[model samples]
Target: MRVKVNALILISVFALSSCKTQVLPENTVQTDIKQVVNSADVVLVDVRIPEQYAEATAKDAVNIPLAELSNNIDSLKGKKVVVFCNKGIQADQAVEILKKKGVDVYDGTTWKNVKAIQEEK
Candidate 1:
């Protein structure tokens, strides 16, 4: 019985390990953002709150706070959405949410980074 329990535990561990999600390298993610930044149809979304968004953000970036993302999915359809926040944390979470809903989404790291990319263009 002890051996059977150990074998079951091992199998479960292996299965869980195999289910780990793949995260793209930072450089690779940056490359993806750069490639799409200049596209006319691309949508830059700032995931910060309305107050923070009012202060400053990338030009042409729509204000869609992280908490409101799900309800606003319909507005984001048919466009390549790039999400960013004050820092990269909220943006990363937003990317996961959007990706699950089949939106063409990319993490733009931070609002500052997205603004810089826009200025470069």
Candidate 2:
């Protein structure tokens, strides 16, 4: 019937719209505290405001805060982007955004975790 056809169309549209790009695991991420500090081909982005990044950010961390993530997305295309925030909230949000946009992104999470991981090295 017409109603069934309409419902099928609606479901198809919903499924297509809800489709999300692939999300690589955090471990597969190439950018970490060690790679950031030791000088490598890493795309370490601080998803915080410029002020927060300038206050005391990781070495060689590029400032592409969450607010400007969408606009500056092109710069992240086809690259391994690792995002982080002060306490992991914003970074998690950023990871979702980047994944939807079909970017290869990793969650760097909190500074405490980054420091701890680095110390363990």
Candidate 3:
């Protein structure tokens, strides 16, 4: 019974941790990502799979799906990077990983929002 209780506790801990979203610290996120996008020094990344990116992605945005993100960290380390996935889930995951690696990154979350912001500029 004790073993079962310990296992249940472990599982619960894992579940809760996985559900937590990795967001930019309030100070780190800009009110509008366009400020970054419009800058010459920034990188706009689409974190969705290549197939999805091919369907449609913001102009000037590069594809770097989440699975392959870690391998490309060196190229992004010091750059201001704005990232987004379809609805933000994968983008959030990518942001968490990037932050851990000390990359200057922002989670733009939804592609729709990214596009809208760009169009307005």
Candidate 4:
């Protein structure tokens, strides 16, 4: 019985370990969104649904949902990008994707923070 329980625990551990995961950087560089917004060279990408983007987003931010990011990678290449979502979850994922493709991207995390940065003097 003890051996069976141990085997079950080991199997559960293995199952959990095999799941795909994305880890955020422990020391991510602070994203100066205000600076990005003011710069003509930078592109602000809001990686939320179109409806969410239409409801609220930073000025000049483009709507490209996380699922559609890969399709638009070519257009985003060779440019400074700042990514933000409703919260930070999808934004972090988008940052990871962009970084893998050699895009200079800043993970802006929450939209509220990005908005505040834009509003700051």
Candidate 5:
């Protein structure tokens, strides 16, 4: 038997294939980020590996690897989540994944820099 690729599937495949996987510098407003962190309803998650995170994740940051994000949706929903990976690709992907699930998300590089911003306040 032969199978045909539907137009929607083809379009989706092309769309995702064309999607950029690069990690850009964060554009999430810092002032708003600080406000949200103070709200105690936000989660700053380090999506890198445990070893990397154990090296130095932020004060309130949680270490939940990117590959496991789907399994931990309940912990991410209905809150502001700042996701960070080693350099940022995984974090960007996490932001997209969470946004699709109706979660408010941000993509910062890592807890190190994010903490700098928080400390500056």
Candidate 6:
């Protein structure tokens, strides 16, 4: 009887833990990129390599590769910055770095997404 009850409790704990979903931190909440992109107070940053950015990037986006992002912090100061890359993976990483440094930043995902938001204006 004791073994059976212990097994049931273990199963219940596993079930509850498996059902949990990961939640993003408060600062990582989704922002209204469409509206924010159009504002003059916002700066759009392309975290892709220069070659990738030169090929195609959102209008008015400044190319700052992920490796060089930290070096350009001063340039991004005093503005709402939106960072994007080819697939957004780097952008997510960039957002975390900027957040630590007290920069007002958002994960704009892909440069294509930022361009789409601009075009909708």
Q: Report the number of the highest-TM-score candidate.
A: 6
> What's the lDDT for residue 51 in model 2?
90
**Reference-based TM-score, model 4:** 0.71
lDDT of each residue in 1-121, candidate 1, tens digit only: 9999999999999999999788985434645577787789899999999999999999899999999999999889778999999879999999999988878888898989988988886
On the 0 to 100 scale, the lDDT of residue 55 in model 6 is 100
Cα-based lDDT for every prediction: 0.88, 0.77, 0.87, 0.87, 0.77, 0.91
- The parts of candidate 2 lying over 4 Å away from their true place are 1-39, 115-121
Off by over 4 Å in 4: 1-33
Q: How close is candidate 2 to the true structure, as a TM-score?
A: 0.63
lDDT of 4 by residue, 4-92 (tens): 99999999999999997877674356655678766779888999999999999987899999999999999999898999998799999
**Residue range 29-115, candidate 2, lDDT tens digits:** 565445643335658788888998888766567888898999988989888777788989999999899988888777778655554
Cα lDDT of model 5 by residue, 10-121, tens digit: 7899999999877744543344655654456778999988999989877788998989998898878777788887777888898888877777787766676677767876
Candidate 2 vs 3: which has more lDDT: 3
Q: Pick the winner on lDDT between candidates 4 and 6.
A: 6
Model 1, position 43: C-alpha lDDT score = 95
Segments of candidate 5 deviating more than 4 angstroms: 1-34, 37-39
**How many backbone clashes does every candidate have?**
0, 0, 0, 0, 0, 0
lDDT of 5 at 95: 86
Residue 105 Cα positional deviation in candidate 2, in Å, after optimal superposition: 0.6
Worst 10 residues of 4 by lDDT: 24-33
User: What are the clashing pairs of model 6?
Assistant: none
| Candidate 1 all-Cα RMSD | 5.5
